[model samples]
Target: DIYAYGSTFRGGEVGVVIVNSGSSAHEISIGGLAVAVKAMGWLVTSNETSSSDPLSARGVMWNGQSSPQSFPLLSLGAYSASLSDDGVLIELPPYSAAGLVVYF
Candidate 1:
């Protein structure tokens, strides 16, 4: 199952949260905007969805990078894409969550 939540902020910025709870991947298209120029976001997920071990369950990655252990914060890799005429297309992996901001 896939769930999506979206909210429009000031200055024509739209924030979205997509959650994929099932074991299959899903591709979603978002449209109906006046004009969408770009989309950027981050994804959080673990290696496995079924693992119950404390370490495995607690381990999470931001945009496919492991958590940092020292200072000099880890650089979050942004997911950027140019919107098509139809809209912005997003792919969600199983048991993952994505936070995105769409700019107009």
Candidate 2:
């Protein structure tokens, strides 16, 4: 289970995802939607066929009949999927992007 006990915000839209690498379902909690750390679950899938696919090459992934993949998979970014206020994003310091994950 993943629990967030701090504050998080974005000057622009932000996407957050939480994955359960364990064999069983995990629990998650955030303080709030705006200030709380956002989280979501990503189902484990088979080997990726495209660079755009979620087939993370970081670790050994189940080929539909194997074990779990390693952390840090190849996923799309939120900015590429969502059209946001250009000014809002452009004005943010580079550190902002470092802190947030742009999920699709």
Listed per model in order, the count of residue pairs whose N, CA or C atoms clash below 3 Å is 0, 2
lDDT of 1 by residue, 1-104 (tens): 88989899989799999998777788988886547788888887776556753234766767887754553534655889888778777788778889889888
How high a TM-score does candidate 2 get? 0.25
Deviating ranges (above 4 Å) for candidate 2: 1-11, 34-104
| RMSD, one per candidate, in order | 2.9, 13.1
Off by over 4 Å in 1: 49-56, 70-74
Question: Whose TM-score is greatest here?
Answer: 1
Q: What's the TM-score of every candidate structure?
A: 0.80, 0.25
Model 2, span 1-104: residue lDDT tens: 22222233465434444433323333333222333233222223334333343334342332222344443444432232232333112111111111223322
Stretch of 10 with least lDDT, candidate 1: 47-56
